[model samples]
Target: MSRQRVVLSLISFLLSFISFSQVTTEVDTTKIRIGEQINYKIKVEADSTVLVVFPEGQTFTPLEAVEALKIDTTKKDSKFKLSRIYKLTQFDSGSYTIPRQKIIIGEKPFYTDSLRVDVGTVEVDTTKQKLYDIKPIIEVEKSSSNWWIWLLVILAALALIGFLLWWFVWREKPLTEEEEIALLPPYDRAKLALKKLDNSQYLIRSEVKEYYSELTMIIRKYLDEKVYERSLESTTDELINRLQLLKEGNQFPFSKETLHNLETILKRADLVKFAKSAPDTALIEMDRATIEKEIESVKAVLPEPTEEEKLLDQQYKEAQERKKKRTKVIITVASLVLLLVATYVGFGLKYGFKYVNDTILRDESKELLEGEWIKSAYGYPPVYIETPEVLKRVQDTLSDESKDKIKQRVFVFDDAEHLDIKIITDEVDGGEQGQEDIQRRVVQSIEKIIEEWETKNVQNIITKDDQFITPNNVEGSKTHGTADFPIKGSDETFEGEYAIFSFATKEGMIAHVTLVWAKEDSYAVDIAERIMNSIEMKSDEQANAEQESQN
Candidate 1:
């Protein structure tokens, strides 16, 4: 009787343990179509205060968990029932199993039973489907909205050119009055000034002071031109002293009477002009007549120019002409350089230093950026983008057996030395596949690209991949790497950089952009970046419109 009581006590303890650790799992269906959702539920019953945790992530292989739904909780007397649900799907048609899921309740873990699922493919009636050949290459025109920018640039450039031409070539600069006077012979210049003074009515206007000033200037100028170098600039006493010394030294031929008369007239004119002393008009006339006669006398007695002096004067005139020419040349060159610098600065500020360096240094990438860029739709679900050059369509020549499985269109711009860009769009037969199948297709495309690189003798390849998203929030995958390629007909090799962007559209179109270029070509990289930034996948309506237009 005691043994039977112990057995009953042990049974009660086992039942209590089972009630405390209750956990179960169930699925709404065991079979589903590819990409069809399956509801998986886990239930746990424990004390009201016990905390329970459910398994997370893609722990269920072959069946991917799309979402972990909110946990539902219910209280029953003194116990709490917690339930967690997950939405699961399979991309490929196959038999799969959701492994046991662990549930933790207050530090102790319990597991739910495993479940099996069957994924079936959607059947397509090929007889009712229509097959179309790849569309012909459509040439897209460059954008014209930014024409005003180019127009302004051209205008600024023309203005700079015109300014340089005016400064250097087309402009006619006039000589100054002093320069014109300097061009005349000294004697002729002095005589011309005296004649001009005579034509003036200074004396007739009752201007005795003016008359004396003119009279003295005429005499001093004549003396300066014919005999004394400093006569025009020196005072009356200094001029007389210089003349006396010249005459005494026999350096110049001058009569004592002539010197005395000249000195007297100059002193009288200075006193009349500076001291405001009134002079008779008759005295001024007499002084003018005497000055004219003295000038003639001096001219008659002047020594003739020697061969050496004549040669020196000729050489001096030639030197002056050469100097003027040099000055003009310098001015022209300086103006041209200034205009060039101004133009460079204007464009540099508008574009950037990279643009300036690329243009001036003849960088290939810079040329592409500055050149005309075409915008176009390529493939079935068209990819919209801008490129430096128009992409040409390559004929698709896949075998007949595989053609029904996939349709692809390719466009390319290949400049073997600098850049190679290829755009591809593919439409696979299946549309209901999951993320894994999409990812697998992308990987296959990347591998194909790498294989093509191998055919081109590309070596030392280094690759990396990451998730990418477009400006429109469309998600994609990006694979980028570097490699070395052997130059054609040479043993030498050059470094090349490459990038591949793969995207699966909502309409089941798979599109990719593949770009490759010499690593030294910075402008090519810039072009690639611009094209990538401008990329957009066309919607169904837009794609249909494009096709209609092409048709």
Candidate 2:
């Protein structure tokens, strides 16, 4: 279902709930004016995830909209429930018919009967009364209630300041003993951790795994803190990989032997901790002492200068000299795979979006173009002033960017329901219009629709304002547990997202449109863009003159 209808359906959910596994439909306000606001709510209570649809004709839509549709899904104990509130309204004052709406859930679609309402002409008061004929009630000026309070506060503040000055004249601040000691990190603590290790009575108690794990942790934490500064609490494989990287980068003070000992100790500790194996205390003490010695030796010397390092350096130098010889076979293969995926997704999206954007438009436009139109000299640029006071707002928002590129275009489909489609020309590139709408308009519409959908759908919405993705916070679709992408943009074209949906309107004249959004690398968008760029838009009247000349 469309987002607007989803919201209206939510209203149906809240007000009418039959049972946990069932659906009950109810409407409180049967009558409404053509363009006035009215409220309706529907609710659903279920045990599992359920997809629902609202009555086909009644939904939140712009121009024919009173407010954005609101879908409220609430969970109670083990039951999953959804609620929708629709602020239904119309634009004109006239008797109108609302068709029955279908609600779908769990592969089943339920519906509400068609409802009718009476709309009367707007009532106005023609009788005008004198502006100041009524006797004015005399008002008395009350005493200043805050004057004394302000005076007293100022006097108190002045006295406090004066007293503080006199007190500071003889006052002194002495540093505490604790303040003299600087804060030290785990690395600094690790050097002295051997002392803590000595104090710990591990051998006395039979906490074998705990004792060994703690010792290994101290060693790993020390190496990470003092040497590489990675979190050693991470998995053993991660620690080994990080250590190898450090070895390669010459970013740590450790030989392969020392690293091997550390890894052996850590792996053994993991085994003892998880496998419930008892470690020999005597052997552990001996290994602990050995670990201490290795740590000290590594501290005295930097990364081991093995022949392997020299070989690596020599290979790097040779690679640089003969750079063109290396094709990076691994990366080349990965790039090919990525390109294949992009091509597939791009092509699929292009078809999906084309069907949504073009076929419907063509069908609708055909109905409206009855052959003749008045020459529109009044037509202005096919761009909308999206930002009224854009420069000032952009200047305030971004210090790096001086101004924003805000663009929009409103196309009037001849058939408002099904847009006229299938425009052809002799050459493939030579078409009157593209299969899709303008880029800026697409981006803006998609962003708005997604934001609205989020508000209506996600219970606890956290709107993110920035676009840059950092490694630490990439939150890939898989990582997020949901596949919804945040809206993104760049200056060239709003080339960042997929939130807008192209859909047909009730009027059929407005088809494949509503909140139509496109994502980059989408085949539909790419094809539509290629076709659109080839064709230039002109007023209807200019087309007649061009058509005659061409004929």
Candidate 3:
């Protein structure tokens, strides 16, 4: 009787220890068509004070989790009942298993039983299906992007600014009165100078010395141009001696009276100027008249220009006009070049030399940064992101052996030297063993990527590893580093920075986004960062939700 009582007591204790928590797992269906959904549900019952953490991340290998629904809770007496649902799907038609998932309640861990699912392919009756011939390759014109338009606009603006600066600031002003007179022939110029002198107030102001000085200069200028080129530099006696020699030589035939009058006027004017003599108005006027008469006398004796001389003078004038035009052109061109250089320097000092050069030269990286971008999704279990330009799909031919084990899609944008971007999606044939060991696999993948770079002549690699979360809350592993990269088609190399982002799904699919840019190019760096920030994982649930909303 005592042994029976002890057994009952032990059984009660065991029952009490196991009665604190209970869990149930179920799916809406065990069978589904390809690309169809399976609603998975889990329910738990426990005390209100216990902590519970359900499974997260890509734990159900071979069956992808489309979405994790919000938890539902209710009260039953003093206990709480909690229910959680997850939407799952599969694209390939095959038999797959949903692996066991762990649930932690308070300090104890419990696991739910695994389930089996069969995804069947849709049927197609070929007899009723229409068929078409394969299309031939078509040659399409390449698009002329709007960056050229922007370049043209910038050039036009600079040109207009230069013209305005020339017009308002640096152009030649109109000639003054003296300059206009100087453009006339020597004879006409001298006559106009005398008339201007006559208009002076020398006589009215009792400026007798100035009057006599003007009287002598008028005749000296006429003699300088018509007779002797150096007449203006000669003294009074030297001029008279030169005139006498000319008369004797018959180079010029000056009358005796003309010579006498010229000699007397020059001497008197010199005395009035150097000796500071105060000459009377009558004497000043007489000297001026005599000088004018001598000019007329000299002209009468001077021989007329020969036809050859006349032709030579005309040719000389034409040459002078051409030279003036050439000088004007040179000045204008020089000024324009100077203005352009100044503008470029000013912008460089304010912004940066590289920025100005890139804008003018149409650097690929710079254009990508400033140009309009496109936002689209790539690959299945899509990666949604924005990029400066659309990436082109790469068709990779694989061997039959590789094709059976894995399928891959690659998209890329390469600028040869400055920047390169690649997106790769790979799907394995089957769920890998030890799929829960994500960190080790990720590290192996990163090392493999680095090894590939080594084959391409990338060297001196420095790396850092971190966890990255996208704007949509999708998590992935990020490996980034700096290295020396071989320039394409050349023996040269440059310092460059690189980033690789790796993401995985429960169905054994992996996606990698790799970006590389020259370290000296800030624009390329910015482009890479922007592309990284724009990345998001577009789940099947979000796509369906959007479609339903649209409907």
Which candidate wins on lDDT? 3
| Index of the highest-TM-score prediction | 3
Per-residue lDDT of 447-514 in model 3, one digit per residue for the tens?
A: 87799899988999999988988888888878998999888889889999999998877556677888
List RMSD in Å for every model shown. 16.3, 34.2, 8.9
- Residue 481, candidate 1: C-alpha displacement in angstroms: 7.5
For candidate 3, report its TM-score.
0.67
Clashes of 1: 2
lDDT (C-alpha) at residue 527 in model 3: 91
Q: In angstroms, how far off is 492's CA in candidate 2?
A: 59
Sort order, TM-score high to low: 3, 1, 2
Off by over 4 Å in 1: 1-183, 204-207, 248-251, 273-276, 349-354, 375-386, 390-420, 423-477, 480-499, 503-512, 516-526, 533-551
Estimate candidate 2's RMSD in Å: 34.2
| Per-model lDDT | 0.79, 0.47, 0.81
Candidate 1 residues 144-256, lDDT tens each? 67888999998998798778667656577687988788778766666776687778898779888887787778778778876888988999999999988988888778887
TM-score of each: 0.53, 0.23, 0.67
Error of 1 at 449 (Å): 4.5
